[model samples]
Target: MRERTMNLLKLNIVVLIEKYKKVTDVARELQLKQPTVTFHMKSLEEELGVPLFHSRKGRIVLTEAGRALYPYAQKMLSLHNEALRTMEEYKGMGRGTLRVGAEPAVQSLMMPVIADFLKRHPGIRIEVQVEPEQKLKALLMVEEIDAAIIEERAALELPLAFERWNEDEVVLICAADHPWVLLEELDPGQAGQERFVRHAPGSQLDRIGQAWADQHAINLWSPLTAASPEGVCRAVRAGAGVAFFSRKALAGNEANEGGGIRMLKVPGLEDPRLQLGAAYRKEGSPASLINEFVHFLRTCAQI
Candidate 1:
């Protein structure tokens, strides 16, 4: 039989077991007549030389042999989807669903990029999932997402293709009129004495900030924590305490008179900048799609 015939068998079996249990329902779902579905079901069982399905209490159910083959059917269908998506990439950038993963810290940077991408490629579908650093990497590795925007350092350690996507200036922010504002540069030692608003524990920004502090042997007196960059910015503006934030967090409000946040420079704060990157699995990904998206990312980074 042809490969298409085998695929048909796979599809019918999968839908029967996992989706619609009745042959009529399966036929309706597949847009085939009831007899056609029954024919395929009988054909599959004969080819396997085993009874694959049987009726139980007027409901069609998979037999032991059918259950054993279900996983293989699922895998075949998944591969089929990947194949279709890969082929779609070659036709043109005009169409295809682009699934992207992003860490929370980079979300602000992603919004404009995604918006512009959709406008330029109107037929393309885009799905954005916000996940933690490790989870984002996990999704990329499994091909759940076509690409991700996250810290370059995090992507560096993974087996992925990385392109520096953006420059996220990690700066210390406090109320505009705070005493430290008048100083040429805040002393690292003084940071130990002031009340600090910290990024939530275990976050990428939190970890990087902590590592920098440890490197300089400076201890921050943090009694408050914010879960997001925006939250941290709001807390700092409200005079909760000074906190570290990416320039993205200061969007629309940075250096403006009405925005009560001031970006500060701390002496010995070496390279207080995080490099964000576009990352994707090095193999088994739609290369055309990734390349096209990365091109947009590079363009967006310059603006």
Candidate 2:
């Protein structure tokens, strides 16, 4: 029986090349000469007895075999890093970094909870990136970040699992001086008459708001569409238009503060709720710190 030689370095080169889709790019990223990267790739293809990439006009695209092997290579690299961390921990070093992505609205409400989490796991360094929902999902799919907190769940199509951390009821908010503030409840017939501020189209909140209005036969006279929840809130506060927000978002503000804002229940919109959660790639090894963070978020919501 012939013993097959397994070259880990060659495997890493193949993975890097496929990930970057160009030898020169991979070389620059790895801080190695382009020739060196190319050499390893060629050697790996030979050792595997198959071509790993299809080269076309200097662009490299992964072959089927390459695509199949990429995840295993990633797992191997992850294990190697984990082994190094274990050794460091054995040598009295007990610190690591956690990269997290979050949608904009969650940044304000979720950060305090995350702070409590960091206090408990003081040795785990934390980094947070604020991104839109789609971009956050992209980062998670590419393994760029360990986890993310997102508002609208519909847009993401990644092979990731989510655990609901908190749920909040969506409410219509308007400046206290707005005409709608004087009404006991919103009337769908009058909806078309009022200037409205809302999240941009395709946002989870926007979709929900639109659906609710449609169901009630309300035609919104949208005067402002903002990309972020805070933007919507600010616009409403400035008397630009009425906007829908989660009750949790407006919890701290007094009704009359800054000339105030009124939180009105959308007439006929039942349980207009948003579920906020932590999401991560389903196949990867779960980080203990991330698991702990999820647990903390759950506990906070339960309280």
Candidate 3:
């Protein structure tokens, strides 16, 4: 007799068992009788000559062999579904998963807009990862993420495409009660006399602040350094010292609006500015998804 054949149903049953780990649940999802599903499982195991799942406490657990096969099975099913949908929609639909990387400041500030895009395009799945500018750039170069939203593109000259979305100026922020806030005209020369709460040395924001101070012949007395925007904000709120923040970050805050913290312009210092951009790999790119996402960002920026 000829050997039996493996079918899509059998693969689906294995995937369902791995997901729910209960025969009853799998049977319900498949809309088949429990015994029939169990029979298919047995037949599949015999054909493959390996146990796909092990039973424990009346629940199903995938075996090592089953674990290895699960991902491939899932991908096959996904491709089948995608093909059907593509045909049904006459190849006009934009569907698939988009993985994006962003820096901390962008993640916190821009996530709402990104979430809105997801809501509008419910068919498209999105995953956002937070990383520093350098790491985000590295991931883009390696094709690890589809795209990235980053600040200060001057560090690495990677062979990638970028679109400028917005520009923000770095402002010096201090607690409302801090003596620096009361100054009539703030100059970078005052940096040495004040204890500064700076960002980590490697960050773009830190570099800008330090460069501004140095150019003005001021010594930066940084006793504390933070790796996160929120940390620097909190330290500034606690009267630690003045730190540089983006105007976009301070906008709409009660402190900024009601004068809880003061935003001072540094005289004779080059106003540090950052251009936020959306970047993607230039070769073999996912053109449709990238275009849609960039359009969505442009709409958001307009609003």
Candidate 4:
């Protein structure tokens, strides 16, 4: 077999097999003539000295050798893009793209930091993907996203590099006039008996609240559930029930707009804080931008 090069692969095999699956369609997608696309395909097969593609069911499909090379082609393309961006950065162009992933629960916090980062560096482009922690980690692993912001607990469990950048306090909130608001501090026993307005099941707060309940042997009776922090706050303000919410979600005002809601202090609870962290793969993408964005995230947490 002859020496194989990236130029020989050139993503033609990928689009032909995975996307278009036809010479004409691949040609149109690549903005090249059909013959040119066919030439590239044949060249790739000849270089590898293997039948990478065969016609079956009227569609172009990859043979075993071609299927095995698909992932490497994807990585090579991703690395090529990254190398271009890195070169642009080193040239002092001060312009590149950063793809960031975050869990939906922390978007409110993540957006502000993203906005501030763009304001400081207008030339750079940032794409934000909001997904669950597991999805975000998968995207990071595949080089689909440059970095991820997730709960510290979830981030720690992943094999990627993580930095614990912030801590979000979980404060018990109730309607302003609720009787619990009058108490300086509520014990676990008092909290256990109250009807809690819980966050939707599977949410970060919901998990934390459940674990807290189990550790204290408190069987929480949640008669109200909201899918979002804002919804939970609205429910608490309307006197539906009490809930534990992140302080950041409350926007740092315990009074919560005209004193409609109040934050309560709870004692004897093992943990009342939700930790947040930024995670990223150690290689195969731009590191500088990821680090800079994480710095902005930390700065935003301080504010």
TM-score list, all predictions? 0.66, 0.62, 0.65, 0.63
Q: Candidate 1: global Cα-lDDT?
A: 0.76
Model 1 regions lying over 4 Å from their true place: 1-90, 253-257
Best by lDDT: 4
* TM-score of candidate 2 versus the correct structure, residues matched by position: 0.62
TM-score winner between candidates 1 and 2: 1
For candidate 4, write residues 87-109 as lDDT tens digits. Answer: 87744537778998876567787
**lDDT of each prediction vs. the true structure?**
0.76, 0.74, 0.76, 0.77
TM for candidate 3 is 0.65
What does candidate 3's lDDT look like per residue over 1-303, in tens digits?
Answer: 649787889989989998899999999999999999999999999998899889999899999999998998898888889889886543343566778887765665677778898788777778898776778777887888988887646423677777667677777888878887667886556656788888766566776777777777777888998777777777888888888777776764433445567777756655457788788865525666777788787766632
Best by TM-score: 1
CA shift at 290, candidate 4, in angstroms? 1.7
Error of 1 at 276 (Å): 1.9
Model 2 residue 44 lDDT score = 74
Q: Between the candidate structures 2 and 3, which one is better when assessed by TM-score? A: 3
Q: In candidate 1, how many Å is residue 27 off? A: 31
Per-prediction count of colliding residue pairs? 0, 0, 0, 0
